[model samples]
Target chain A: MARPMGSVRLKKTNPATLAVGVALCIFIIYFLIGPSTSDFSASRKATAAAHHLSPPTSPFRKPTGDKQKPPPVAHYNLNNVTTTPNPLENRENILLLTPMARFYQEYWDNILRLEYPHELITLGFILPRTKEGNDATRELQKRIALTQNQGPEKDRFKSIIILREDIDPPLTSQDEKERHKMENQKARRAAMAKARNSLLYSTLGPATSWILWLDADVVETPPTIIQDLASHDQAITVPNCFQRYWNEEKNEMDERPYDFNNWQDSPTALDLAKKMDPDDILLEGYAEMATFRTLMAYMSRENGRLHEEMPLDGVGGAALLVKADVHRDGAMFPPFAFYNLIETEGFAKMSKRLGWQPVGLPNYKVYHYNE
Target chain B: MARPMGSVRLKKTNPATLAVGVALCIFIIYFLIGPSTSDFSASRKATAAAHHLSPPTSPFRKPTGDKQKPPPVAHYNLNNVTTTPNPLENRENILLLTPMARFYQEYWDNILRLEYPHELITLGFILPRTKEGNDATRELQKRIALTQNQGPEKDRFKSIIILREDIDPPLTSQDEKERHKMENQKARRAAMAKARNSLLYSTLGPATSWILWLDADVVETPPTIIQDLASHDQAITVPNCFQRYWNEEKNEMDERPYDFNNWQDSPTALDLAKKMDPDDILLEGYAEMATFRTLMAYMSRENGRLHEEMPLDGVGGAALLVKADVHRDGAMFPPFAFYNLIETEGFAKMSKRLGWQPVGLPNYKVYHYNE
Candidate 1:
């Protein structure tokens, strides 16, 4: 009887179960080697509190009751020297830029929750010329319709503009040695830079005072993020990006550094950066010690001891805010290495060369999608 | 000395005083002959009551407390049979159309005061390709910007579209004989019809359920006007046109009939309508008895007794409500006579031929600007 039953069912392996087993294995492997999770401890918290001595309230804050106290004065160093009073209540015309891959419902939901006024914000997007992009746009339109029905009196965005670009050229060879081929990387970066420049020049009107580069993959951020960045009053600023990863063993989620490109330049690193051929890209993680720079994500020692305003040699596009005037003043995302960097990082270098200070917030972190 | 000075001044014949005297004489003559003011009397009031029967609360009313009673039911005659119903609560998509001539601050203020949900309405404009139209658009933009800044959270219109069309070809000749010239009238009517049709077709989306044609010069109306019209549930309906005029004798404002196009057809009128050549024009006021029809504006008999709902052979476009589906089903403003009528009158005939009922509210009035 047992033999007959086994022959009827167990004799052949179930394909679905086999596939699940393979998937589980791949998932585990990916987490094990992909990135290091941020370690948390009591001492780190104390240090973080000590390092970030004062955090300014956003300027967009609506006045509360008379009992509400005034915000503490914030001091920001320019050129790592001269201190200036922060412009706390400045009303700026902000232009938001996003290069979308696929539409996510949560992305819009998060945007609607932003603490800033919708009337002052102009949203701009660039979608890839792919079926996915078209589907995303359709989904977004339905979302807008739903929003319209729910609140007939809600204010709409000041303006909305959508653009499309073709996919970047693919690499010709898969060989590991040829994978880092300069031509392929340059082609990909160039396409990205071109797409970004087109969006900026076409949509940034005279009224716009600031330009925010937000990647679609960045799914979660505090609603006060925009106001917080504006409060810093820097020429350029970026927030640290963290990716949330599930710790299967711990039965909880953990955070890992997603973008470690924002860093402070050292003499050796500056030399190495300068030595690179104009066309050569200085890879982030690979050229770490050779470039004599330490990433902001790694530099915060003793828990929260990271400096409040760290000089950034390069900026991550996942979330970067810049003065619109800087862009109008000739700063652009260089596809080929200018100062041994390209794309967003290259843009930061270009801005610096124009005598604009770029700052990074080591303690302020925005989450990126795991994918 | 005073007498001598006065004589010298009077002899000089001041040019400004002469011009003022001439303008006053012209104004007096125009007022005396232009249009007759509606006469008032107790008998007329009784007759108006009898003709109207009942009036209902407008749908545009915002709810108050339990003590606030429902609006009185309105009495309407369909095929000459009386019926009463309260149509105070119905929600549907409405497209507001206006052919603007010049910018008026009061006009925008009145629109903003409309009781309907802004998100449910699409505001569309067709401006003449002239300096006045351009100036109006610029002023409108500034007004919108001001409104946005004052109330950032207010619900904005679902969408706004402003289009420009070359002013219908100016009349070729101003000769009084040529002014009523058939070709000139046809050309002017055709131009207006084309402008209206272009605005309607280009902007009306599938989601739109109704079209409200309101002339920009017709400045003021009850906030609940949209709801009032929708409540009728007729294929086509119009509000009585009242021009607000300053009464020099009374030193107060008075109202008079501005549109008398809505009429009941008589055999003689039908015969007259049939006899007209296709190319011949039916001048609004001039075609009176030739068409054997009684204008509803005059048929009201007494001051207030304008029938609430009247059977009409034609209607005016000052303020017209039409079903979107009717337009989709092929009703249009024919520049040429289809039933010995052109422009809005022709539109009524076209809709009737398509098995739709056209009705008018003679008692309900909306005001027009003096200009």
Candidate 2:
């Protein structure tokens, strides 16, 4: 009786023929699969190199992958991200990030008036999925379409990405009075921090050299604001945010401090932070939660000293610019209380912890819309 | 000496064992390769379905692929592409296309002032590679980023796409006198036809129900222009284009007819077309090449009739709205002369050949930029 191929006796089989068959099969499998496996591994490594350099505190870091290891040093050295004397010749890309809840035409006009080369600017916007957020998004999109589709090529932005993601419960009202209520500060600021981080991570491409966190309500920035801010060339720089409001008693428009978050931490503020609950957040510009810190807003003079810079313990989102390496080093807005601070304030603490100095321009002012 | 495995005769081999070995080898090969081939074929069919329904006249059609066969029937039936009475509630997407060489702030302002639900509008632009074109693109991009980043969500556009591709030789001067020269007419119009076609093909998504061919120079369209033109619900509709100019002689602003391309094809015009060379193009509003056709521009009265529709043989591009299926069915602007007409007029001729009627709103005015 004939035996099956698998059951053939080793003594009866020709060892030389069996060896040749096995070698041919192995060669064919390698020929068919080697290139594909190599390509797959290469792409996996590239992805890890791009996104896996997360800090210990990053919520985005993978739980199962290298969590105990320290983050790798950033590819972009902080020393190399200095400001250029002439930005017109500089080709480095700047990412303009905005967290929007309301749309204002005046704010859009100010952005359009910036004299920086639009081709080097990439815009990223994150808006909540609420009714007001949807309304703002629609208006913003219409304006974008008009400018992008009709403008000169050199003045066009490199790219614009809008993300609609809600990180907080929908607010019943966007009224300033309702928004400023002391009880809503922690939740509101934490939601905003999440939005900012979301925009940063999703839009921070490899080409980004700087990040400009300009609030959507910042309506009256100088046309040379980008050049002015970039010329400082600091690790992190923030301009004083002010608003022109009608002083009814004076019967004239008067400028007032807008963002109180740009401040120098005082001994009293540190003591208050220590006494607060672990989950409690510290907020600026409120009488009930007075930190009594020296504010950049209060340091403004009549004529505005353009080159004046001061080291800050906390920063404001309004017209703040930072080198990309600072972010790549794993500094982001904290959505939860970190040392009794959250959001933009927490971001300053995190940046300092990562060895980046946050500086404030006391007299370089960007105006917020007075509504 | 032992014989090799291949040299073993059929009588010496076990037929059942050989059959089992052959079947196992075939199954392994199929297991490794079957899914990939099926996926590849599916994607290829999808691509062919999306792009292969081109007419015989399309210059974009592949020369070697099924040239003799008629184009497949369009998936979007023209009869079903009618405009809704209420666009506010309509979910249909409208693509706004423009061919730009310059950017004007007033033109951008007019687009922003439009009262349509911005979320339903997608803007598309094509520009030349010339210096002026670059300048226009830059300025336009600045405006787009501002609006898109700051506007209310409900008022924003669905999307915006800008394509920078030059089809014509760069013009040394953009002066009206230099541009209007009869010698430059054919090349200029042919290049424009190519730009228009490029923008249309690149931006026409499957969801686009309507296409509004708005010129970048048309600076005074009504806020409800989209709703107004869409209410007509025709396959193709064009509003009369007029320019408001300072009448030094009359000492006031006077409205003058701008687009002369919207006209009824007279017998004299057909005779003129027959005598012209195959590559020659027919231009409107010039006394030198008068075709003696009745123009839609001349049909306007002192008070201006808003709802008056006039059937026409040729159409102007300024504020022209068309159903998307008319374009999908192969009606594109001809870069070459078709009936001695090129660009917008050739598009009208092509539309008629494809059985879509071209209609002009005699007094529904869309003002062109005076400059």
Candidate 3:
């Protein structure tokens, strides 16, 4: 039998070629599952929960049988009342929490313009996971350094905390544009809920007396906003939000779209809430509702003249302030629908479940940036 | 001639192998000189300079002859004389600059303990390029976030800034330890001068009235240190630096290793300066000196009892405050020897050359941390 010399040579080369092929496979595998990969497994959630500052039992623990009593309607003032300024000795320590994705310079400029004492205002920023967000955060950091280094203006921020990480976006296909928009609404809300909860859980300290949740897009607010909110001394309080849009037809400054999240319980809303499945969500602008049940924006011109105090069943995150004790007692932003509501509305519901009333200021309005 | 079939096959394989080898070389080259490489070239320097807030100019500009008149001997009080507090309208903004390689928590804690109003103070930190330094800086950032989120004590900082980058180490060889030590000392001083100048160039703004250089290792200082220094109204002022060493034999706290940089132009020092080449550097603690010629530690008991003001030819970064106008007028920390001194001492020379006297608080001391 003739020796198969070519076969012998091929066999010798096989191991070397096989090794190269194996390395290529390994490289591809690593690239597929690297640090950039997103993981939302139960183990990861447990890990996140374990890192919380407070001992985690159940984030939404009911206040036992004694607390089953219905919460009384809350009333808060929106008029430009001369808020009794507390003496320096008894100044409340306010931790301002802002979940932001953009507008670094304007936010800092507004913060610099705040009339409150820097010694008492702790600024905390939670940045989302996006190139835009990261860039904005870096810009803010440089500004902070610049102001601290050479700005003649006093750097009056009591303390500053900035946390940045990626927040997952809603899953959508390019082909289904309409579905994408609808799904994105819920997805963005869910992502925001996660961001807010993570920030509050990780950063909230025992020394904080109040927590102020301010949206990044709200550009103009009175310097005394913090003081005014704190003076109410309520479980939860939110100011009316109005957008500042250029009146295209009139060629002058005009109020634009307003936030309608601040609302009182209406029969139509209650009926809509009842019709939805327990796991289904009820969105504000998407839900079918009568004109009377739909909560409309509080116009700027009508501010400081309406009812000083009003009951609010649901409130938006534009400018909400809550006593630290309310959160410490176990209230959180429920990401999923707890009672046909989700996100901030769910948070309001959770707060009331613990016997804390939710109050809204109809007349006191903060200006939102035109989108 | 008979065709060599095996040789023909070998030739074809060789070309393929050569092509693979060339491809490997190109890949390795790209990886080796990629974006992650640390470069200290003129281009990189230009890039760094470009990032500066102010227009780039020679950092070490000499004052013209008309400004050569020796500044009038400055007199400042260090005694706790009932200082007249400036009214809110007249309050001068102070920028506290601390270039640190370590000690994040202590620096912030000490900063929080400062008695100055947060509205008037701006905190700036420059961290060196080292693994330890970077880690400490990250820890400080986390602590800042934590304190603002959770700390019960009021956040008292007006504004905070942190800068991070690698500074080149002094050139040295392992063969010569003694020479390495000497060269390293000069190198470190030069490096510190560069860092200080860069920070000042990037952060200094028109609003700043004063720049305070405080070392991170200073663990204890009078709460009213800023007020006391600002009250002097000198072009440049430094506090006496005394290290609290564990007195092993005495079993009590004792000041050992005092900062000798703060000094008068003694005949011995002036004579030494004259002998050295203009390019050579003069170091503290190395030159021969008598007890009186060397300015030693100002004992706590001796504080507020010595000459309220003493002429200082040089000062340490431990605690030096300079009027903003001096920096605005082009005074800088010269990295090279000027009058046979460099860094902080060179800075003193630069300031003096511009008709600004350097003042020393012989009776006021700030405690250095026990290393």
Q: How would you encode candidate 3's per-residue C-alpha lDDT over A1-371 as one tens digit per residue? A: 22232232222211100100000000000000001011211111212111001111111111245633221111111111111234123555566877766754665777777666654565666664355655766776677555533343334344455555333232223332333244544555555665665455434532345678887767787877877766666778788877666788999987643666667767877787778775667665442333233242442244265436676777788788887645543455655564666668877876675467988777777876654
Q: Candidate 1: where are CA atoms >4 Å away?
A: A1-371, B1-90, B148-155, B167-183, B249-251, B287-292, B301-307
DockQ of each: 0.01, 0.01, 0.01
**Model 3 accuracy (lDDT, Cα):** 0.51
TM-score (chain A only) of candidate 3: 0.71
Candidate 3, superposed: residue stretches over 4 Å from native: A1-89, A168-180, A287-296, A299-303, B1-371
Q: lDDT for each of the candidates?
A: 0.52, 0.59, 0.51
**lDDT score for residue A64 of model 1:** 40
- lDDT of each residue in B11-116, candidate 2, tens digit only: 1211111100000000000000000111211121112111111100111111244433321111111112224655556555677888777787887898888888
Q: Tens digit of lDDT per residue, candidate 1, span B1-371?
A: 01122222122211111100000000000000000011111011211111110011111122245563322221111111111122223335577877665667766777777777654565666665555556776776566545433333233443445555443233233444444434555655555665565556544432345788887767788888877877787878888877778888999987766765676667866766567764565655542334446665554434664337886778877789887645643456655454567767877876675457788888888776664
In model 2, which regions exceed 4 Å deviation? A1-371, B1-85, B167-169
Error of 1 at B86 (Å): 9.6
Question: Residue A234 lDDT in model 1?
Answer: 85
For candidate 3, write residues B1-371 as lDDT tens digits: 12232232222111100100000000000000001111211111212111111111111111245533211111111111111234123555566877666664565677777776544555555565456555666776676555433443334343444544343332223232333244545555655665665455434432355778887777677877877777776888788887666788999977643566677667867787778776678776542322134453332244366437777877777788787646543456655565677778877876785568998877787866654
